[model samples]
Target: MFAKSTNEKPESIKRVEKVTGRLVIFYEVDICNKSELHKIFKLHKIDCVIHLAAFKYVGESVKTPLAYYVNNISTSLVLLEVMQECRVKKLIFSSSSNVYGNPKFLPVTEDHCTGQNCTNPYGRSKYFVEEILKDVCTSDPDWRVILLRYFAPSGAHRSGLIGEDPLSEHLNLIPCIAQVAAGQRTKIKIFGQDYNTRDGTCIRDYTHVTDIADGHVKALKKISEDLFKGWTAYNLAAGKGYTVLEIIKIFEKVAKRNIKYELFDRRTVGRSWQDDDLKTVKTTKVVGKRYIVLHAGNKNGFIPGADLVFSSSTKNSDYHGEMNQAAKLQNVQTLLEAHFGKEWAQHDNLEWYKNILKGLKDSENENSQDQEYEEEECNSLEDEIAIHI
Candidate 1:
């Protein structure tokens, strides 16, 4: 159990508070300690646990293999044991793409071999924990474990308030890009360029961290079901790969400025060993019929009609039922048709309308405090109308 640090904002706390509809509590405890973990769990009704704590540095794990093992594997073992003891069966684990080692195929499936060529202890630790969970499920029928292997995470919570603030001074590419955009860094670094890729650089799939968080919530929704009662795993990825240079270009476009960078000659460790061969795995898609339908709608230039209606309502309505005189519903309809396509017209759902109504109602509630409401602007939340509404 971890509490908010000085780096976390009041908005992050408020966001969690609003969603859960309760006063969020904070706890400080080492999960590695069995008694402490059990004590905390016993104290509260933990309907779900999303484990996001782990030593993540690939290079550092190579140098400090023992430390990595002790931190990653040992802590996980302790937590699992405590969960078992406390009868808290639902667990959503944070796994990694590094566990895949060098992928055998273009798009690595869940069945793809893992722990084969994991270059470092950090990956191996995750792999070991996964195996542990698999065994735990095999031995016990009550436990529910969902191991979600994550790709690279990009972007903040959209409020710009809560972003990845790692303890280490060394930054990941997206955060580094953000820093460069903010004028904190003079330039970015292209780690390796001469590798065998479309652009002669290592390619990776980057998923938004908030998307990953939402995935945990999604998994939690299924944990109470029979299908996901035992051990199950899913890859939480963006289903597309972007080269370093391409990402930098996107950042440049987004920030409306050129980003400076140079190629370095460090030994490539993860996917490829040499500068000549840049290995990459194509990202995985959401393997569901509904997802297939949505994909078709997306390609055909149609979104769920609810998205259009809700988007129109948000911009046109003045807080309540009152409409904005300057805002034209037809313009909003045109914008939605252009942006979401004909799919919005095809689909029939009022869920998006319901959510907008909920937000509006919540915004109007007499009990809701002005201080309790925090400004949150999330582009991802735009798609919130997709399936729900």
Candidate 2:
């Protein structure tokens, strides 16, 4: 099998090779470099391409939009140009549900309008690529493409060898919760708690990363078919939404650990209080009480804090984070199940999350052992003095 690596470490690639039991011919070349990318096409006989190279962090995209645009959009263009030059027409593009922006209706389908109100550059980039693919297919009937719009992929591989390890800050909800549970972070910051939802928090559909991979495989198979032509999109999601609070509670139950979190007024750029301003408010001591006003793009500003300032409640609920029955109707899941089976599409999110916690614990243990060995190897005056004391 052929692969391209940019940010992936050698250890990660080795682990993947060990698990797959195949030698992955990986080129450590930036996809944006046309010459380097073209060399790979010439070196290997690549039948199909899975285009997953992109800058995907929403908040980071907002902070550095130019980087997002240049990398995400330009890379796709360069890759397409090279692919066309090499006569490689089949593609499975990794896409995001953020292309739909704030959903106008529940249970978003492939037919939902995209590129309308994308909140960040990341989403817009994906939309632009999808449009580009559509145009490419229109121009040439031989090209086949499948756009997989994934919603919040969580969990590691069953073997726990490879998982989501962000190079920078953990911006996503699952990783934030995991950090808090692992005591790496003091507490998670909930953006807002007054949204019009079941628990007054924004709800999102989440699917396991494994299931998303399976979806890609299914898409690849479908695109490779003789009858399959043109470009199509599918939503790879569990089809039901979960509130932020619900996810925390579920994690607490599964991990047997308290996850501390603080709520703040939801504000994203433009006319909103900055992080430094919020820190000042948090540390300030008032005579009787403290009042912090947050402008929510309206006349009457709202208080910055929630009614419940902090919570580590371990309250259990009947909610098991199950997939919505309606999700069975989704085109991707339907197609996957039809070809594989009902069990192929079905996944236990709670169980997957538990596995993630287990992996995190294992990593912690390994780190602890390494630290102990290093301590044993060192002998300092301070250590002797502390021992005598």
Candidate 3:
């Protein structure tokens, strides 16, 4: 439910419907807008919501921590508040393997410690939402929620109608390698090669996008059942890990060309980290009574503060000035406690934010379009883009 953002390229809502043959209703509205979201709940009877929206880039989160928190966390809170008023309680939140942070073991589990090792604002924001959801389920028995934490989402559907189409060609490994193969880019910039693994490239659990979608469908169906309640999370992954060089070799064989790449120092690619070498890295900046999370990572994997704050991550001035936006972050939680002190804990704002994020876009976009289809009282479809290959 978005059509505005300097940094966001939200996939068209109509295009996904056309390819999948599913009845769809779309609204080009930002989730940050409270009234727009509430309008949706007033118009429909949404049973379940699969929230798959967020500002996902990890490096960008470091440069602009406040934007990430506001968009990913605060915006979610607003959505949850609206959903509760409408009494639509079932939710499926799109979480990430990045929330697992540096892997303490080979195969990461849902029970493995979270929020502790999160290295970036993007990951930290996800962790924060998960914690919020857990608290929500605790306070309310009616809430049924499932948090699906996934790794590298790759491959396409069997129909070949929809697939991964990144806004930036170099954003992810599969897309970046494809750009190099298709001659859209000069060479792939391999983040690092000094890891304690074979070929030294990063190792990750690459699952098909269809499987990830299927996982969500399964969770939705499960939660819809009477027996399901509270919060449960699972790792939607292949369990086996593939190194970057291994993936490139497969691409080389298929494309019949040597994909050239330049090696840089180890940097956190965010997800696709399950190896032993990766550890929690935090960059802290103290500003008066408030402390801003400047960067999150280890010596090898974290983005240098010099490159993050003063320099550009996207090479565009608008995207380059993320740090500038970060300076204006509102520490709502801290400030609320500072003035209201312990009285703040009794407020329902925490509960409101938790449940709202899970169904924010779905409730708001129910009748966003002029010619939206007839659903009696149902809001349909999430906005997504498709690829042809």
Order of the predicted models by TM-score, top scorer first? 2, 3, 1
Weakest ten-residue segment in model 1 by summed lDDT:
285-294
| Model 3 stretches astray by more than 4 angstroms | 1-12, 269-389
- Say what the RMSD of model 3 is: 21.1
Question: In model 3, what lDDT does residue 31 have?
Answer: 76
Q: Write the per-residue lDDT of candidate 1 for residues 117-162, one digit (tens) a residue.
A: 8867888999999999889988998888899998887777776656
Worst 10 residues of 2 by lDDT: 269-278
Off by over 4 Å in 2: 1-6, 267-389
Maximum-lDDT candidate: 2
Count of backbone collisions in candidate 2 = 0
What TM-score does model 3 achieve against the real structure? Answer: 0.67
Candidate 2's displacement at residue 35, Å, is 0.7
Looking at model 3, report the run of 10 residues with the lowest lDDT sum.
380-389
Global local distance difference test of model 2 = 0.68
Q: For residues 45-114, what per-residue lDDT tens digits would candidate 3 score against the true structure?
A: 7888788778887767877889899889976787777777788888889898888887666568888888
Listed in order, each prediction's TM-score against the native is 0.65, 0.68, 0.67
Better of 1 and 3 by lDDT: 1
**TM-score: which candidate is best?**
2
